[model samples]
Target: MTLASGLTLTVVLALVSVVALVMRPRGTSTVDFYLAGQRVGVATNAWAICGDYFSAASFLGVAAAVYATGLDGAWYAVGFAAGFVPVLLFVAAPLRRFGEFSIPDFLGRRLGSERVRLVAVGVVQLVILSYLVPQTVGSGITWELLVGQGVAGLSPYATGIVVSTAVVAALVSFGGMRGTTWTQAVQFLLLLGALLWLAATVIGEGFHYGDAVEQISTAPLGNPAPDGGLATEPNALHPGEPAVFGEPGARYDVLGQIALMVTLAMGTAGLPHVMNRYFTSPTGSAARTTTVWVLCLAGVFYAVAVMLGTAAREIVPGAVADNPWLDELTVDGVLTVPEHALPVLGRIYGGDAGLGVVAAGALIAVLSTIAGLLLAAAASWGHDVYERHLNPRATQRQAVRAGRITTLVTAGTAAGIGLVLRPEAFAASTPSIVATMVTWAFAVAGSALTPVFLLSIWWRRTTAAGAVAGMTTGVVVVIAMLTAGTVADGSPWPDLLLAPTLLAAPLTTVVTVVVSRSTAPPPDVERSWLIMHGTAADRHTQALARLVLAESRRRRREVRRARR
Candidate 1:
């Protein structure tokens, strides 16, 4: 069958799922609607977390990065996966213990400051919107490549934007967090399975990973020759040879690379959607366990993604006219679609059926991620703003309605922005889609939120005033830097703007510290410190696990005796 036939079936199946999820009734309580009644199993919640975390970045961008930049692009996966380690070790358990529906809610309660809450909500919303728009862009690009359809009067890109936003908004509005979590978990597994299968098939076809990497490393990174602009040949390698962009020992600037890595690694704790997932776990232990699972799952997925990326770079020749859609996008007969490299590999290895599965998985990646972000955005706007500030007397149903409305508004706004800006498609890949957008989100979150959160949890003297001051300074700096670097084309900033998180975050720490020293610390800072570090809760969690295990053993023994 044709690729179009397979793609059509995939789209049909995904859309039909909306009916079953939306028809269900939402419960009255905030917990029921937002945290899935706090009964989500560890394994399920882990999958959902992966779903929320993967985004379009993981499905398309990672492979695309690999195809385009070789090992350097693999750092995207490393930074992303490493982000969770901090979340698990430092953020997840305490965050779950806080038992809030969203990060803004948790901060509002922890510091008892409305002003802080408001500021956080605004920052959270910005982060969500920034992240959301790119995912929509990614969805559009994927759909255009896969199905070749553009709904009435809309470009294929616009069609993707409209369809993805509508579907995700509908799912979120109807299901709330409860329905969304289940779908997200299932979707994550499907996404990973697709990645795994694709990787295995590539390897099974006698693809040599090491040889492929050597070839890619030997080739020049970025556009060849005139388009790529020349520099001095490296002491270690030729000017055209692929090398890190910054820092010593590495091909690139090491400091710059580490900065990007640290920003992502630290920023995961502050991301509203990711932070919100901790609330869905029933207990702190469950939250910690979820992170552990995430570590393992992410490790496997990223490793495979790098391999697939290397294989794509090696197998997919630079020639464009040989493949469909290559000529339209490729400059000077070379396929420029770095993102398409992976999809092409899918078609080559899996044929039409494989391409369909991979495409559908990519859609699921965007849908699942957008669902989580929209829910988080809704929680910030609906629960934090509408319910808490506007209509304090809102009933559970009314609050949920507010959440739905917020979801629609947020999704619509993101879709509209994507329709307008339409991320630049490079070569064969959606290079500017999910990953770059997500990087912006990380930069903002790292710069604005991570410094304050780390200080708040670790430093006893961290005053509410300090937290507020620090976050504000960070957010403003990050915005200014990014705006100047990206929007103001004539700005003097170095190409180092490619990684903004490095500069934006440390300045935030300095601002926070300088401000905190001048202000009186909050009186309850000691209590907050204890909550963050004291071990009583950890002991209780361990005891509870033992008790549950003992009970299960007793029940098994009784059943055995009865049978005998």
Candidate 2:
């Protein structure tokens, strides 16, 4: 790592911290602290939502996966972008219209049961921590590349986690949702700008995307793996021979491919952080618009990430002899870890300064994700558990205080977990370790929360008891399946156990519907539907009414001033 790169990362993080603090919400209400006072606009919220979704998985992991697996990795980008379609078509409007503080809050109130809230809280926390750990781990990995040393004799990885976790925790505590929203929006743009810059530079160097794909796929997908690195097997995409980058089965079988796509696509509907962002929208229609914008912005971002990965496959090996850094990371022109794919490109293309910019982008992605996760955790605990159940008479100030405390605790716990789950612990065998962990979270969310959530909105027969049973069934079944898979890591049934969402989600839906049939429905289904399915004209007219009220208030103030 170069001093120039280290300084750039430090300066950039400091700026983000300052800006978020400046945007910190003044009101101490639950809405102010947790959902940005429900006042965020479409464009800004859309960008923030993109930043929340991207994580280190999209910014770093996707590229590395593509570099390592050829065409198989492109599916990850597709799965991620496609996930939002379900959110837009099914969940976004109703969720925003029936706005609550968090997922647990929504579920609890929708079902009129504190028990449902408590159960949902547990699942939400599980998902958040599952999501948070990977972001924290990604921070350490990026730091290891950007700055090789640790502060005060700590390991490079540990130092990275501690510093990043501390800074992000502080920001979440100080700024709340309002601060996080602004910071995330800015972070996403910066990340996009970095990708665009690198893409432009590569294209100017006469790099052809098609040529790179053909060249890499022409043989089997291969990269430099030093003595300490994990060994590559025969290409899965190709089966018996070296796999081409354009072929299927490069990394997974046909079933595995379908499973992966289902896990990721349905995952968005249940992600606590992403759904919470919708609650910040001014109206349901605004939330729908925001989802549309997210799809557009995210498409451009992931497309560039995929291209960078392909280009890096060709760029890095040739630079090995010329760049000393390559010697440290590569063996026989192959990268030690696929995660090094993007950062190494930055150094080759623009030296330390370029490497610094990309590294900072990686860190920014991690930070933005951690912020969203921490806030989601806070909302789950403070609004759903504490305010609603523990302290029914609590003031807004008290509620905000509880949320701030929870955010700190959640952030710290995730950092500690991240420190324990070091890459070395995993033997650095999988370069895309962060993505793998994130996929677990997605699987859990899609299975446990999403199916039940959609049912509650669209099927009025969904009862509190059915929701509880369905959610519990989903969580328990998916966890059991994932655990079984982990134990049988090298076994033949790997793909099925590894990504059980395709089975888990359908099972959850079945269990929910069956239980609902036996349980009593809510007495006021039409009332809930009326609130959720309000038309665009209704939304527009409501907005006009609010505007009129504000104008009349302003006129009255002016008349009072004239009389004085």
Instruction: Tell me the TM-score of each prediction against the true structure.
Output: 0.86, 0.93
Residue-level lDDT of model 2, residues 74-129, one tens digit each, is 88889989999999999999999998988888888888788889999999999999
User: Lowest lDDT 10-mer window, candidate 1?
Assistant: 229-238
lDDT of 1 by residue, 12-37 (tens): 44653663275344567777777788
**What shift in Å separates residue 304 of candidate 1 from its native position after superposition?**
1.2
Q: What is the TM-score of candidate 1?
A: 0.86
Best TM-score goes to which candidate? 2
For model 1, how big is the CA root-mean-square deviation? 8.7
For model 2, the stretches where C-alpha displacement exceeds 4 angstroms are: 223-232, 235-239, 424-431, 536-564
Task: Tell me model 2's lDDT, rounded to 2 decimals.
Answer: 0.86
Count of clashing residue pairs in every prediction = 21, 5
